[model samples]
Target: MQEAIIRGAEFDRLDMDRVPQFLTRLVTRLCVDEARHNAIVKKMASHPRLIPHSADDLVDVVCDNAEAQWLAARLEAFSPKDRKLVLMLTSGFTRKEIAEELGTTPQGTHSALYRIRKKMVERYG
Candidate 1:
């Protein structure tokens, strides 16, 4: 879920309004491809080592990576408001929508996003 959020944020930063479509396409393709891959792997009786690793193991590797560590450290520096703002933004909410949800103004939401982005770039760049 954390990984998904991170990927979603990256996608949102690239193209905000396209996020829902991107996520739908991505999820559908991944599910279909995973099912096909699993079927092929299950049918194959040879080479057990050729099978793909589990999602947990892949996530573990990602969590342990230097870039992930850096990002995590950066995320830790965010205030509670900033953190929620980023999560909401990454999860596909527009500033106006997030402001309404958080009971704040759109300007506040925009400010939060700007600060979060600045912190992320300062830490990760």
Candidate 2:
């Protein structure tokens, strides 16, 4: 969406010829994001600043909000470190970066993150 791109890119600075490539990059990032955290992706898709433009988009907004809220409530039940791990993961931290932040080995971080992701997907997906 224009707004999504504009939020991260300076409209005047964007090369008109690269619009498709730019969109492709966004789509790829989002696809990866959704794989990591479907609820987080849904939450971002329902940007709070915008009103839905159609009946279908409105339904999507409501569903997204519900899923995001559900995920938030579930996150509260996790250990403090686990919650922070999930937060960092959804915020786009690489596993190595997360391991550094959490003061753990990359392999440990990977396993913990995988466990968390698996649990969430099993229960919520």
Candidate 3:
């Protein structure tokens, strides 16, 4: 569809003629991002966000509550893994569930999540 193509085509373009190398680099990154987006969307639709308790999980709670828009925007700069983890957490997935989906140990996922939260706090707090 035109909408989907437009969504994937976002990039700085006018200056590409002046800097020929930019086009290849930008196109490469766009391709990578599109692939990741497609993977994430498929995974998300099949495996829904798992918010169990509204009280214990800050990320899911924020995502469900008033701060969702702000939280989602702020996560854009995070590495793809970290961003995906945050999205999973907000969807109500426990660390164990995330680990299973990502094919890593729960402990490793926990450690990464701790770091991700620390980075987000530093950036957004």
Candidate 4:
């Protein structure tokens, strides 16, 4: 999580043209660690009688809830553009910044964000 925040800050500082390459470099460095951690977790999960109370179990329960499942389905139903707009907006990008990254105007980014927020409220309220 700290690393992701640092990466986001780095991304915010970079020129648009360099962002992709920076992301590629960061992902290359992180992927190996992520894979190793996942493998360890997989092995741990396979063990008999692990921790009685785990965050994974909580996540599983939440995921099984009808409301949570419905929300997940609604999120899944979003178009790629909608998803991208929401993701960028949610990740602390200003309208201008998101517009620059997406090759659109600030007004367009604002419009997209408004629609995305409305859809989220309609789905989750």
Among the numbered candidates, top TM-score falls to 3
**Which number leads on lDDT?**
2
Q: Model 3 over residues 38-123: C-alpha lDDT tens digits?
A: 99878777774642343336654454333333455687787888777767766667667778899998778778866866787898
TM-score for predicted model 3 compared with the true structure: 0.42
Tell me how far candidate 2 lies from the true structure as C-alpha RMSD in angstroms.
21.0
lDDT of 3 at 44: 71
Any idea what lDDT model 2 has?
A: 0.70
Regions of candidate 4 where Cα sits further than 4 Å from its true position = 1-74
Give each model's whole-structure lDDT.
Answer: 0.66, 0.70, 0.67, 0.66
Least lDDT summed over 10 consecutive residues: which range in candidate 2?
55-64
Task: State which candidate, 1 or 2, has the greater lDDT.
Answer: 2
Residues 1-125 of candidate 1 have per-residue lDDT tens digits of: 56986876877357777779978988898899999999887778456777655433444334324333444455766777766666665555656778899999977876765666677788666
> Which runs in model 2 stand beyond 4 Å of their true positions?
1-73
lDDT of 4 by residue, 24-106 (tens): 88788799999999999999998877846532244433432433334344667788876666566545455667788999997
